[model samples]
Target: MGELRLMKGNEALAEAAIRAGVDGYFGYPITPQSEVIEYLMSEKPHERTGMVVLQAESEVASINMLYGGGGTGKKVMTSSSSPGISLMQEGLSYLAGAEIPCVVANVVRGGPGLGDIQPAQSDYFQSVKGGGHGDYRLFVIAPASVQEMSDFVPLAFDVAFKYRIPSLIVSDGLIGQMMEKVELFDPIPRLTDEEVIARYPWATNGKPKGKERRILTSLDLDPHKMERHNWALQEKYKLIEENETRFELIGCDDAEYIIVAYGSSSRIAQKSIQLARKKGIKVGLLRLITLWPFPKKPIEEFVKNGIKGFLTVEMSAGQMIEDVKLVVEGRAKVEHFGRYGGVIHSPEEVLEALEQKLIGG
Candidate 1:
């Protein structure tokens, strides 16, 4: 544990990344997330920790830089908004195929085009559902507040390395721009290059004294080899889903209305739960920490425990609500409430949605 600070989510993420001993950051400037780059620029963390920070010409170049650093078994990261993140998809998929560890933060905004700089969650599906292509997954962490933004950086790195996959801290403009009281933790120490190479010799740094040539690639020309790689990935995914599930349950032990929300929407949902409780609605919250490898079993268990219904709220066009519906499996009614195109709905609006469906219906 280090100290407390009132900071914006974007600033906290950059500061926390530095504290986490990240080896590098490579990202193009995109609103909301640009503060992350600015923080790194202003602090010059490299002077203190010899961390590398480079603002690339494009998202493409940034992700490639991340790829190069990752090839050397170094902790590297980047951030972008929705469209910019979308552009990085090809690199992300290749990284997944190669089993490279990295972190990508998507400070989401309205989508399908050069959407506004305001907050939105339209990237929900893109982030969670193999954004690039070909049977892949990013270890997704959805942070609901500035506090979680600060806390999730080291956790993201740990998970990324533990699973040897790309990890994401998925947030939106509201969380990115808002100021909050956050308690920062002491930077989680990470393995040095020598230590990492000792453990993961496959990393492509350079051939040493008697070591053989090392290659970093994802291509498998033979069908059988590709099939084996896919199977290995499947096993890794299973292990991750089984062991890496994380979420927050509020009054869900025995509640009639369970609200399923994540990221900034979750903060509003939490406030809605408080208000709903005061009004005698037994409302609870299931805040998703791990967006991918979705926390299904616990949610399913709650439905099995006689929870009547759930309100899936987000800033997207009911993207994740579909997953909630699938997991709920008709045992409990699942309804969705959202505002797309960067328009943020207030807590009252969410509570009203809950009132119509959960309270009155």
Candidate 2:
């Protein structure tokens, strides 16, 4: 354990990856995630801890490199923003199909085109709802602050390896560029080559000792096999939903209205909660950390607690609100508030929305 130091979110992410003992890093630079690669470059973890860090030619190649590294059972990761991540979708789909365990960070920017370099949560669907083509789910973790950026990286790695599935940390420019105090930890133990080989005898390489060549793939031409594979994937997703839901509760335990937010939007919502509290509005908040699993249980619990309505805030065109509505299941009215294409929702704006939608007439 160590004391917290002020560091930008991207730098914190890099430090966390290094501390998490990632074996390899393959990424193409994109704002605001570029600092992550820069930190890895300047830190030169390969020289220090024998980690491999490589800036690839493009996002496509970078994700493919991740596939190569992760296929070998080494703890590997990559980072990119929306456009770059979009390019990596093919590889991400492939990785998911093969059930390869790895970490990916998307410091999201405004999107659909070049978008903007500023903060945006437009990638919520891309992350939580599977950006790539597949009947698969990526374990998506959303971090509202730099603290979560540092903390979630190691957690993502742990979850990926445990499930042998891909895990993603979906952050944004606000968290990535902002500086905050972070408590650093010592590097976790890196898996030795022999150890990885032992665990992934099926990883693409020469045959393991006394074992035949193992092929890692997601394609099954046979209908029966494909159905079985899909069924298995569904089962895995259920396990994830049950064991992986994560959220932070504020005043929902005894409130009439709940605010559902995640990522940077959640940060704004927190301030709004305090402001609402001072005005005697019995407002509470549920900040989602794991966006993919969607933290449905907590929202359901709020509904059970007699919460009447929710304000779903984001930096996108109301993508997450749909998920909230699904979970609310008619027990609570859910409304959306957002600013898209690089515009962020400020605390004042959220407070206004709360007043108009949930807090006032």
Candidate 3:
């Protein structure tokens, strides 16, 4: 094990960014997630790792800052809640279209519109289906534990740089506020200006002599050129889908029914699985790790093996269920169960839903 400590999810994530060698953090404080910026401010990473931490005037400014900095091959990121994230959609879209490397964390709160400062997974559709206006999808990760919240920052940055894609870590108030033990990774070295340019030739850092001209923009006046650019993006997304689809299977081999969930809901489902198994119900858990490049292949495999049904559990009324439906394609009986208004469901509630919605429905 490396460095280990007990910490809140938001603080762990903040520290992980420092160790991940992040160049900068530009964000406005929002509930639950505000702790991320607060921790960074308290730590003063400027003194520690030469990391620049700035409290942007607004979410709009924060994302635009990312647009500017990320285009230069810098590892910059931000965190926000539901309403705050909504304000950054246009900038997020621009970054996606330009294929800039960056990370975003959404410690979600209740919302269709500033609902509350409680944990919620209501942003599933907004996250997976592309929150911003466009046909682009973020490289999305859903952390089920404080450990994951700590670890995925580096992973997101690595993936972002590798593919020149923006990554979104889909966390929530539960994971953000909860405290747990996390083993932190050793610090990575930040890239120098020359190293960044050497590694990422597409970056428009400066007009360096004897180097290729690099233009970073999401604009195209000619429709035909734009069509080609869109096609190229679609091909890249397909490639990511092939290589980066991530999920987990637990107690699934002999299971007759399965519970599909991600992030916080997956943690609750593990207990539900235990309760179900004790009652002689053969239920298993399917945990989604990557939300965008969804692990469709695993679900398809389970369905082919003739699993009776699947129950998609979430804090939202019903968002991820649509994806489950799309993946199962009506072959298996799939239903949704959840609590709305920032209320988290209990294990008993999940077990009950499995019986009523999947097992016996």
Candidate 4:
């Protein structure tokens, strides 16, 4: 631990990027996440760590910049809210197809189209289930607290590089705006160009001595070649599913009901668990940390252990519940409770839903 300080989640993410030794950040400001770039610019990371920070003209340009930087094997990142993220989709698809490593943080606000500046999990489908074209998936991490907002950045980068894939930190506006005590970490040194070349020979850093020139693109006109590429991507996703599913179980040991939620919804579900416990109702929480790899096995195991039912609490109209239903597979009852378009469900409201749907039935 470096030092404990009270900070907003967006600020924590910015500071963590500096400490993570990121080489550059290219992003356009968006609500609930503008603080990330604002903090970076104010801190003048270039003076301290030779980091490059640019306020791109648009989200499209920012994501393309990330694609360029990441193709060179640099640890680059960007942050935006839902609408801006939508603008970056095509670039994100290109990054994925090129197999570049980079981190993206979506401090999501409500949206089908610029719905509100308030917290919402409406983008759950977009984040977890490839928002862009092609058969690809992002390693999505959902942070429920200010502390996690800071912590997941480095973790996202580490995983992104390990697999040569894009990683995403999926947060809500509430977490981004909320202030809480967070313990910062010591700074890590950024890798030099030589180091990056040595580590990732596949990087587009020009042809080295006796090495062939690297090519980075998503275009494959040949049908057979494109099919092979798709197969390879699927294999990578399978490996990630096997090795990278992360989740947190709270009070599940003796509970009869499990509430599945992630990001800000998980925090609210925690309070709901306490409320249910006071009424002698055996309730627990299953907080998903990795949304892309979709922690399915744990839910299956809980069902096997005679867990009664599952209620997915979200800020959207039950996007994640579909995954839960798929995993549960009629082994146990499943339900969804949500408030869409920036309306956050209160603890008592969640408890009421749980009681009415899972316990009462």
lDDT of 1 by residue, 15-133 (tens): 99988989999989989788999999999987878888998999999999989999899999999999999999999999999999999999998877998888999998898898798
The candidate with the higher lDDT, 2 or 4, is 4
Tens digit of per-residue lDDT, candidate 2, span 197-296:
7776657756757877777898889989988988998999899989998998877766788888988898899898889889888888889889988888
Write one digit per residue (lDDT tens) for candidate 4, span 233-331. 899999999999999999999999999999999999999999899999999999999999999989999999989999999999889999999999999
- TM-scores of the models, in the order given: 0.97, 0.97, 0.99, 0.99
Off by over 4 Å in 1: 188-191, 209-212
What lDDT does the true structure give each of the candidates? 0.89, 0.88, 0.92, 0.93
lDDT of 3 by residue, 85-165 (tens): 999889989999999999999999998898999999999988888878877979999999999998999999988988889
TM-score-wise, the better of 1 and 4 is 4
| Residue 246's lDDT in candidate 3 | 91
RMSD of 3: 0.8
* Reference-based lDDT, residue 296, model 1: 99
Candidates sorted by lDDT, best first: 4, 3, 1, 2
User: Could you tell me how far off, in angstroms, the CA of residue 44 lies in candidate 4 after the best superposition?
Assistant: 0.4
Worst-scoring 10-residue span by lDDT in model 4: 205-214
Q: Against the true structure, whose lDDT is highest?
A: 4
Candidate 2 residue spans exceeding 4 A from truth: none
